[model samples]
Target: MSLLSTQHTLQAYYLGLFGRAADPDGLNYWLSQLESGTLALDDALMLMANSDEFSERLQLPADDDWLAQVYPAYFGRPVDAEGGGYWSSLAAQGVSAPVLLQSIMASATGADREALDATTSIARFYSQQVSPERYDPAQTLIQEGLRSNEALYAELAAMDEQFDALTVMEVGESLEGRPLYSASVGSGPRKLMIVTQQHGDEPTGTEAAMLLLEWLSGDSPEAQWLRSEISLTVMPRVNPDGFERWVQLASGEASPDTTIDPRRNSADIDLNRTWDSSETLDLALIPEALAVRQEIARFQPDLILDYHNQNNYINAAGELETISILWPTNDLIDDQVTATAQQAAVALAQGVAEFDYGFLSLFPGGDTPQIARNGLAIDGVPTLLIEQRGLEEMELIAYEGLAVNYNALSSALILEGLMSMIGVITELGSGGLTDIDPALALQIPDRGERIQYQDIYTLSDERIDKEGMPTETELQPEVVGVSAAVLDDALAA
Candidate 1:
């Protein structure tokens, strides 16, 4: 084949294996071996084509290091080693290659590189082939699409008629003077707030929120009821500057060629950690956080949802543990909300399963209490934190294959379910507050197989042995007294 044809074939092959490049290093090695005449490309392709190992390696799990190496090459840019990993960029783009690759590899296989390449090329050609009669030139569909800030803003400007009822509130200016946009809709007495992109690299939620904004402002009957019954405030892009920086870095247009900085705004402070506390050195260091805080204080939303992505689990707040239908406050209303969210999650899990994606609820941790959910709960606004698997590690499957839109569709379903239960929200706050039972406290087992209660706390070293087995330590009378005091305070709440 001519060099042009070879390049075209290679591009097609690469596109065909969207989520499948199992053993990227091995693939590269095979390519090198072919170039050096050490191994025939046909033989190498045959090896990959026949092996289950190749298929297994294509699934990029959370701990896999191959993603760090392959993603940069695919994007035609070098990923930062000091920062998290290439998955960060994938999260920003709202797409995972591993999931897509799994689907591609299963569909095409051949003994020769040329044959494999041709098969992939044909596959891509057919996948993108659209009938002229059925295609609409004016219809805007953002399926698996990424747009820069300028392009997005332009699109929003053109679609202003659809968003006429939505009021744009400029909370603050980015370090680069870009006006941060927050959409406020509805005129109901009760206010609900949502913020996305707190970590700029996590853009799936941000995109989902934007899509929701458009849907709400449109003439849907559901939108009309939501507008009349509740006031919703949404901050779509909390870190526009970081988002722009990531875009530039991913596109190979970044100046100075420094590693990608994961922090928000100009000051480089973690916005999530800069909440109301003494550790907050520079309150103005993160203008985005300050702006959000001001908005929360002003609106005092009855409920809030902060969207984020994780490598492992989908989690909700601990506050949703019980049905609060017996309380008379807005915070208790979350029982129905929690139930609705769980039902939606089950549907989402079923959808993701079609693509072989694993789903689980997030574990309760100290970090959860320090962030938005716990902080908002203190102010009486019950919050739900939603987490989805990182985009870089999604499983690939065959039409319902890896390209299955689980995260996007799950988000929509959750929103739909929430809207359905909106009228019963006031009933959630009907439950009365109760103290935690000391008898229900979790017990930790020691290495000696001894059980301990709240009155006997163990130090880190004393808690575990050299082999990571739990260890036992005798508690001093004073220590036991102090533990009792702490437990009493805790249970008395």
Candidate 2:
């Protein structure tokens, strides 16, 4: 078969099983397998039908109801009597679920085929916009080719057109002249400024910020309530030049240069460090950081969440740490700012605790006021640091011994960050963040020694649950009228 024919077949399998367009990695891998005669079209379809994403996405019963769902899922119609009887007999004769799905998909024709072709055409168009290294757990490198500068602009532009409430703007330009953009929405009294990917090498937070923006722009009742209660400003990607170089290094398009650090800007300045004393900073040296500072000055957010990715390390319990969080540890920060930052951190710790896979610990951050975690707080802007797992190691070791589902890890980090933001916004809107005790931030366990990826699973359940203390609503029910369960439902929704 021609390449086009093979792609159409694969696209149908992706649609029927995953309910989405194929990622370039998976599509290319399977296409090569078919073209090389290593696997037939039926073999590929059967394998995909039995994959974890397939089973998790469509939880069809193993009994006769499977036929009821499968026919409609693939062909856009329920099974007719004759087709139902044939599939039912096959099942009765002990045919497997994957095999059954493969058979049903093969039987499409006429209007069903026409519908499939039209939808597949649309899916193909979507598949084009997605980069080759877009998030895929099945692939080894979990956070590869995170949205390019162009892609980020495209997505933000589309969001601007789609959501009337969301406003996407160019806050400043990087030293390389790439426009630094910020998306702002909501109209409540409380304001939040969330900046992600200060370090170009750290890219997960960029995706998480985009996810949060889309959620805030949504029409759900919880989302609507959030808009009514708070204003938000999100700087999704701060260091595009560093990110561009990082991508080049990852894809082997560029050789490593001794003078250049992918974690800093093109001018070799650590963007996070430039914020040390925003008043006296040399703006020409770090244009990216200056852009962020200017936006913060104008927006004057009540709270700032600085999202970033750090090296992987096992917690004090020896289990791999999924995220490390910290409030301002700088002594120069005001007592009130420290307390408010602590409240936000405590709230975030409790929120992240709900996810079973999330391993939270205190980030062993610097006391230097240069980093946003301390710098902004010193200036009386409440800031919290979120250091998620999986970026430094990815560049250093190339995912060795990290036996994890990249897809799940990739998504969990984003959702965990988004939910943390939502939880904080909810509490801040209801005036519940300030009343909580500030000592809880000090109580968060310190990050343990760094370990190789292979050592992550060595220890079992001894990991500390630092935020084990009562949350805002738990400690003071009157402070936040919204129940924890209600807030949780809203975040999930």
Candidate 3:
């Protein structure tokens, strides 16, 4: 095969095994490996198949079920009983997944090869078109694995040292003695506090928050402009103890030493539910919530963006929601504060909607005063809830939908959300955030229906047809400045 053929084959492997288009640097490195005879084609394929990205992206059991799931992805059909038995026997005989994948791909007949070719074409298009600035290699690295508590701390420290505009501070400590760190950048009077990973399992926000910090702290014209307009603060990971537990469980390294419920703190308290203004920060247990509350009181931000991820859900258009937003819905919240949050919601929806991949929805949340969105608003601090599509949920959704393109989708979703957030922050800093009509948030379609993991693909078409399409007017907010396109250019600049 020529170099082009070699590249195409590798790109297909990237999409097949990693669920993403190969980055230019990685592609070049592997090409060199092949050209220099450092690794043969089969060896290269197995190396990629054995990678952490492959394992994490698939998360499939290394057994008959793995074959069952993977066969349909490449061949566009379920594994027949005979094939399953054969694969299972091989698996039992200690044939590694990498070897099995190689064997399976090698065994593909005409139609299977054609289906794979089509998928490879999709990867090629994306790889060719993906914006280097938008889909940075650093962003990809962040998504590869969950960062350890110490690693997160070190990264923030390094950012603080590297960027003159960025500062890192230890605000408090987690119940498990992990430092509760907060990063701050920019110096404008209009303050915005971003809190993410409040739910341990919801991690896209943490990744996006770091990327946002990297962007904001750089010397780009937009970053400089925004810095002159808004003092930004971010608590990237709020529930460190819970996130630690979650990471352990996810990596199959569950320790007998820690709590099992990653959604809660070491004290087994739902940190989100602990955010009641009526209760003192030190009341009862879970110092993570207290640390957040303390930071909020100290920052006294004009707006707060709480980021999270929700279970799989389809919007009114019958498309999977890329992200959902909700403002303070508690009756106790001041009307003006709630209205401001509504305006922010409109800004966020408008920002994300500019990207064709994103489907905005009004996250279905109750008006309980304990959750951060409601509780913070009750205290007269405007807060908006942003729930991105859950990572684990999307993995299962993609499997059910037979979508081998999920890694690309997942990467786009995070990058888009991060850019949208940056745009929203720009608007907030420039006072353009409140210029949008708050009532437009009401028009943002409701999160249409919950799609259970096992049946999302099966019912997707039916739901889409029955639910009808979202009107063009839905969430069409009249904004003043800082649109997603403008921000996209700014980010690249």
Q: Report lDDT per candidate.
A: 0.41, 0.68, 0.67
Candidate 2 per-residue lDDT, tens place, 95-128, comes to 7766666566555543344334434443443343
> How are the candidates ranked when ordered by lDDT, highest leading?
2, 3, 1
- Give the residue spans of candidate 3 off by over 4 A: 1-142, 255-258, 280-284, 391-410, 457-488, 491-493
Worst 10 residues of 1 by lDDT: 474-483
Model 2 off-target regions past 4 Å?
1-145, 278-280, 397-406, 454-493
- Each prediction's TM-score versus the true structure: 0.47, 0.65, 0.66
lDDT of 3 at 48: 83
- Listed per candidate, the RMSD to the true structure in angstroms reads 20.3, 16.5, 13.0
Model 3 agreement with the true structure over 1-493: per-residue lDDT tens digits: 0112566678667755664557756777898999999998778988887788877766533566677756644544567798889878887788776677767767664335544543444344334444454443221211223356766787788889999999999998888788988899988988889998887767677767777887788776778888999998999889888777655543334543444577677777788897787876555477778788888888899899998887778766655676888999888889999998898887787666545454788888999988999998998999999988765543332122222223333344556567558657867876756678888889988887887644543223321221232222321112111122234354444
How much lDDT does candidate 3 score? 0.67
Evaluated at residue 183, the lDDT of candidate 3 is 94
> Which candidate comes out best when scored by TM-score?
3
